[model samples]
Target: MAEERTESKTTILIVDDSEINRDVLKEIFKDDYTILEADNGKAAIDMVVKSRAFLAAILLDINMPEMDGFAVLTEIGKVKLLDKIPVIMITSDTSAETERRCYEQGVADVICKPFEPLIVKQKVSRSIELILSKRHLEEQITSQTKLLRAQYQQLQKQQEILKKNNALIVEKICTIVEFRNLESGYHLRRIHDFVSILGRYIMNMYPEYGLTQYQVDVMADASAMHDIGKITVPDTILLKPGRLTRDEFEVMKSHTTRGCDIIRMLSDIQDKDYFEYSYDICRHHHEKYDGNGYPDGLKGEDISIAAQLTGLADVYDALISERVYKAAYSMDKAFGMIVNGECGVFNPKLINCFRQAKLEMNNAFLKTKMKEKEELKALHGEDDDYDDD
Candidate 1:
């Protein structure tokens, strides 16, 4: 059974012009591998081309009839078969020149004419082992590459789904503040737009601030949550038609610190940079640049740029929009109040950004108002258009 199995194994093609040399090589490998014989180089090439897939190696004589070993090497090199199957040269001339020429023709090993059976067997075994190992490694690399590609595609799909869910959560939170009636329906929307306008201007004019377009967008999104803590304030003070007493005003001011607390509770669900932006804007948007504002009297650049931008936007929106305690001011009056330090002292740099962004901020406010009117008309059949007071 063992002999039968070896006879059915992959072939070793032995090519030589002498019958005696071909018979010698065949006797050596006859037990371990199936042996195929060719008396001339042309016959060897034909056998190799027909049975290349099943051939393990080719042992060729340098001096042969019709087509020499060099000619056979040249023909096989065209097909790139040498990369997969090694060719060992057998020669009577063992000079340094002949050996160099044999290796240059892509020969794996050179052997003298009076062949040593042990060395021949060992060299053939080693060459076949090396080829098999290389083939296995190539197959593994191809398989791993395909698997990594599939995993990368799967990760991208997961990230997209996560992004949509986060947007929905933000909308729902903003809806809660709207339901409480602390601000007008368009108040948060206006703030988001104003912050975006100012943020872009500041980023362009002051490269030292290290603000990117992405950070600007994050600050704009976070501005909506600046007043989220007002939900904790009582409706009596929040909706009071008259100015609050000193004690009630203090309670109203606590909304900033309280808003930060609320955001901390939600830290686990928010992205790292977004959570930081939200937390800073919420707690410090009410802070004054002159160390006189509420909660934490943070002054100047000590107040984060995100907080500063949101604070300016919040004051502008409050001035132009009708609230329970105050009627809406004109656009010109709102811009003047902020820049002149009437609402509260602000950073000089930010005031410059605010001044430069005046026309854009006005347009944004009007655009939002128009959109709100259109939405109201769609929902309640009200077609009355309102102007900036």
Candidate 2:
């Protein structure tokens, strides 16, 4: 009963030219609603415009003086109040055309006169119930939409943090390898650039490879880990200035598999795609296309594309850079050696991409070399002006 009285605070507007008809409706709804009265359509429109937010329903009469109910409905619609407040036509006109007009004007229902008070009350009550229910559902949907957007934003932030952590781990590992190999820090940078140049050329020139720019970038970054296993090799074998004996060479070859082991231990911390690319490049970068290289002689396309791309880049960098056992070959000689298969058999498709990327790769290496020289000069306190050549 208390709840019922609380709900009765809702307003109902009664519009009719006849005082008796308005009185009848006011009596029927008086117990359950706060009623407002207007004896004509113009007066009703003025009240509705002022009190639309407080109204639950409107009872309107069709045959009225000065203005008809239809004109009032049109005015109410222009202000967009019909949807928010239910309106039921209360009229003596029982003609089908009059009823149709009331409906077309967006009245909730038509109650014919002399009307049954119970039926009029029931129809108006149902319309108000439906409108209230719809509003409640709209509110719920809006709240849920906001929650989902917030959750998606949180997920994106977490993913970015994970990516940064993974990059930091890679950097630390590369730094360790640089110090152990007695190679300049720029060696890793050159390898990264070489892999990128070849990978992008392959992606653009051969649609069959199905490589996206994102995948190519991942492959280039993973190339840094290709020789990470060399960290496990003994300094006697790794830093030897003469040719390796057969037994020492076998131990050196083990670095490929050992590098994969190191990457596997980090699986928990690495992104799935990055881990897979790193593992493949570490384990199979030495495998030749003709199945004649070590440690696992994976042949042809059996080798992962990431490994193949990194393998080519690694060999190119190794040939052009001085190592413990050999002098650095000139760029022209190194390019010829790979094309002629003097080093090992390589994929014809990759060789073609290599040829296409040669100029860009050369430029990238020289750029890195110049940068390293400038840094060394700066460290030695040399003047800024230096020869471009």
Candidate 3:
């Protein structure tokens, strides 16, 4: 009475080579479920594909004339559309290798022949639940994939507009920040170059970090504004000839927070990856993993990864190159200091990555410098030629 109550609740497809076996099972499970019968694996697959109702579970017999269940499984596996359905292999073989192979082939369960009606009932119940779960997950992935592809297409269409606006926004901020030491704030250019270098390394090493060629370009473009908050600080503090007074230093430290906030207020940063990049450059750039840094004083992994990495790039550029108040150090000097753990300013993880991609990063730095020179010349109306050069 209970079995009849149960099979009535689920859709079951039973495959067997023997007509007698099919009759016996049908009689046993008749009251419990809506049962569909097939004489072999081929018929079971055909029934599954054509049925309007979704399959709750499949009982596949391994031994049969014409097509064995194993062969049917191989064919079923090849059909991508039907891959989510769970198949319970019904066979008397009981060998360890056979059992292992069934699991490796994605079979949900194995049932020995001369099966007790109760065991059949129990296995079917479990496998049906599993199959339904698998189908639900597959449906979720399919829906998500569709959503992603649509979003990607929309983004591609708006990409050119995004790039132009983003550039203009960053340029304005850059101009504001560097107006005092504008002659030397070329460090802004180098910082973008450094971000691209690290971005490429992260892409090659861990593509899962949301790194892409487009993202690299975006990082290079957005990184220009990392120091934009400095514009809000007083000229007295920014252009001071020596170390900042503690009060002045506090005001200076506010730049990181200020930069992030400024970027946040812009509509352009509302798009994809903007907040991620901004969050990194803004909040945690001054944080130390060991908890001794500035702004948030965040330590360890609590630091936003984007901020931590940008911190490393920012410090390296500061250490290696000329500033309004300092001369350029040789690459060897800067690199040695970086590797030796200078103060607590940098993320060691990023420093290690710098070593691995050192040659590439330096090359990118030179390219960025050249690009900056070109921009400067263009701004001054320096080049005139064959109307094209």
Candidate 4:
């Protein structure tokens, strides 16, 4: 249908030894198509394979020197191009075995010799039309493949931009959380480094989380904002050296809602999903197994998976790090308490993975702490900035 608009003409290849038959056939199709002639089977094969465009149907003659129609069909079968180009066997001897062999070798249609000029034209036209339709489908497939590839590349670049941009925002937010407690950047930095180590440990064990190197990089950068909710906690409660009183603790629990609100607002403006992702992790990371968490008491499986994972990192660091009121527990004691204290609280599957790869997790934890110390020293090399109250 589309061919009617352009210099769109199908090509008919006539393979015969006799020049008379070739000219006669050429004359038959001259008005409707652009005719191409091949005196031998090899030439027809070369023209079909090397040239770009569809060969409607090959009118292959049985009687020819060197390579006959059968040989050409066989050659085409050998190369697996029979599906693209339909072969119509033109033979004088309508032998049973020859016809069977052509069909066995995967031919489209077979025509007997002493050919009727009108019938020859009709058969060739029909076969060509079918073959050309198939070729058009292939062209469409190639076009779609190229389009999908381009879209995939563009999406990948945009995700990179989102990953880095979100990290900067999370860092800024976590600094706000850190200032609420100690006014130093240490708490945010330490938690992020600890979570990075935990993430790597989990990735090594369970790759189903899509925790590839690139993904972990994104997770680590985003991890800094895990406690961003603490920013909304009142200064009296946040800065209280003593344990939070009952009423003060209730107010403290509202920080998660306030954090979610702020991030949700930012997500609305950015038209992005990364902040929402961090939002879930930040808001629900405190949830326990039996629905004891404040803000939204989502228990166990009800909690976001990202938040559950962040909880592991946050609690692990809290147990190990030296605090103002309580001394840090030893790693062995801390691990035992984490595993036994809450049932169905920490993801059992995650706990199992951590238990199995305990040594690796320990090594990662130590390495992360060391790395953070080095980084902190490099950032502030004994600067004389001190809190003189």
Candidate 5:
């Protein structure tokens, strides 16, 4: 028994109005526990608050001078220390109503004043064990909760890192395709910028697309790979100075499926949004809204929205760009051709957004022209004969 008391080092608080009752209880438990005595409820509350970390149980009396047992329980409840310390009610009254009130006030057990010494010790020991067990369980739950939260945050950070890396790899791969197709890197930049603008407008005006901001961002960047497969086309056809023959056009169209296959080889891209947007734009950017597109005649909404945004961006750039087959059309003519359906059918909703976004598009074009002039002036000196064409 002495060894057992030493192992646990239990502490007990006895609150009572009578010095005799306090003395009796202390005498009973003094051998087995570190006993704390309080003459009134206020003193007991103070003791419980001060020693809450070590105190195992509280022995409270129902009748006291200023604050009663119920009032003390209320005070303990205010500090939320009731569960940490098991309360046992000790009083002279043995009425059922009084016992019920004590139990309702969250006491561990109620004992009449003519209590047996052995019974008091047994009850207090059991209550102390119960409180200790509850505190142990609560501590375990708090520890586990903290651990899970940390793991979740770590997982989120790792996923974000992977996404950023995949995007960089895609951009680099697209740069290689630009070189192989004999186009400047500016083509990729302009396509990405144009599609981003269209995607933002569509997300704001069309709720049916269910497009999230993350999806929009991925789609914009993924558009850079729309011509990744043009790297596979023969130089004779890819660099043709005139319109392609029917056979040559057919060969050129195969780039769509070829680009998809090439993107699939990149095993590092694990994000579903990135993969889906990249694959869809690469394979279906040439698809028409009227189901007359090649490789697969997916019409209207059947073609992924990602493809639609990228396709329009491609068409706009190709019109304004001086390709081997044609001189650059003026901006007004290109806009008229797209809006008048000369550039194949397009989604009506996107068509409206295209109209609204044209002003911004022109502004971006002017900025590029200004940057080009700056570069030219740096190369040829500011006073050199410079043509604005």
Candidate 6:
């Protein structure tokens, strides 16, 4: 009984100027539908706009006073309710042109006046079904689009988490290598900053290096792994106070290849650019531009620019910093050695960039030198009278 009452209360609108015509249609539908009536086209348009949520269909009279059925349809078009509400033209005028005009104005069907109640009921029922189905599909598409956007955002967060974890692992590897070399840990920091500074300068002066700012930053972090092979050398050779014996030097050189092998052991080390940069730097930082270096002896442009950058950074730090066997060279002397090719052959363009940046590099290193002195003093249990570089 409740379901039947709900079906009977479904709304339908009847529009006509003549009282008798409106009454006749209302009589036909009042039993099955709740009928709302408007005496003129203007009033019908207002009713449709106000009650469109519950209004199922419109039965419109073509010939009316003031605003006519066509004018009412133009109003419906303005509200964009043509797809959501079905409109059926009900009129006495049966001329073909009159029917054609109704159809042109987006009427769903045109029925001559004195139309059978059965035909009117069936047409309105079918139109409402089609409009409801379309609205349901549109709702489903909107829901799915929102879900897809949420999933894409979640995926981006996961990728960011993975990148941060990779960076942490890179730092761990750098610390392990520094501990093995008995380095003050400042070596890693200086090399990272030096490589980053030089990389940015090179990118600007030589775009052919094909480096983005992001790549330069990543290379700076990866540079810490360049000397990772030193971990494999015997402590006696690594900490030797004098020049290595020829045989000891040969064994020490193997650190380059051994570092690369260590990196290869990480199963999760995919062929990403940072990992590739670390591998090349670990194996080839010793290679000279003239092909006179150890291990694979990569020469000229054959060497990756990443390896070349780390090599120069490593050598510059080595020359200007004190080692157990040698006093720190003065800044002027260190500069002279590189320019004179006393350190090893390098890419000429890189050398030119160094020339331009040498003053700034020296100033930056002065700060690092002071910090290193403090650390060294603490390690040696010495007084502040330690000589400044």
Candidate 4 global lDDT = 0.70
RMSD of each: 6.2, 5.6, 9.0, 5.1, 5.0, 7.2
For residues 168-233, could you state the per-residue lDDT of candidate 6 as single tens digits? Answer: 766787668657764636777788878888888899999988999988987887888787778888
TM-score list, all predictions: 0.62, 0.68, 0.56, 0.78, 0.75, 0.62
The positional error of residue 366 in candidate 4, measured at the CA in angstroms, is 2.3
lDDT of 1 by residue, 170-232 (tens): 677778887898354478889889999999999999999999998998898778788888899
TM-score of 1: 0.62
Of the candidates shown, which would achieve the greatest lDDT relative to the real structure?
2
After superposition, candidate 5 runs with Cα above 4 Å error: 1-12, 18-37, 57-62, 69-83, 86-145, 181-184, 269-272, 330-332, 368-388
- Could you tell me which residue pairs clash in candidate 2? none
lDDT scores for all predictions?
0.86, 0.87, 0.74, 0.70, 0.85, 0.83
For model 3, the run of ten residues with the poorest summed lDDT: 380-389
Candidate 5 lDDT over residue span 273-300, tens digit each: 6777888899999999999986799998
Which prediction has more favorable TM-score, 1 or 2? 2
The number of residue pairs in model 5 that clash at the backbone is 0
Per residue, candidate 2 scores C-alpha lDDT tens digits across 1-389 of: 95455345988899999988988888999888988899998999989987787789999888898899888899999998888888999888889999998888888888988869899889999999988988888889999999999999998898778678767877888789868863635687788899889989999999899999989988888888888898999999989999999999999999999999999999999888889999989999999999997887789999988898888888888899888789999999999999999989999999999999999999998898888777667755666566433
lDDT for residue 293 in candidate 2, whole number 0-100 = 79
On TM-score, the stronger of 4 and 5 is 4
Name model 3 segments beyond 4 Å from true: 1-152, 183-185, 206-218, 267-269, 343-345, 371-389
Q: Which segments of model 2 are wrong by more than 4 Å? A: 1-138, 197-217, 289-293, 299-302, 329-357, 378-389
lDDT of 4 by residue, 146-246 (tens): 99999999999987776667766766776666555643255556555555656676678766676776555555665566666667777687667689889
Q: After superposition, how far is residue 213 of candidate 1 from its true place, in Å?
A: 7.7
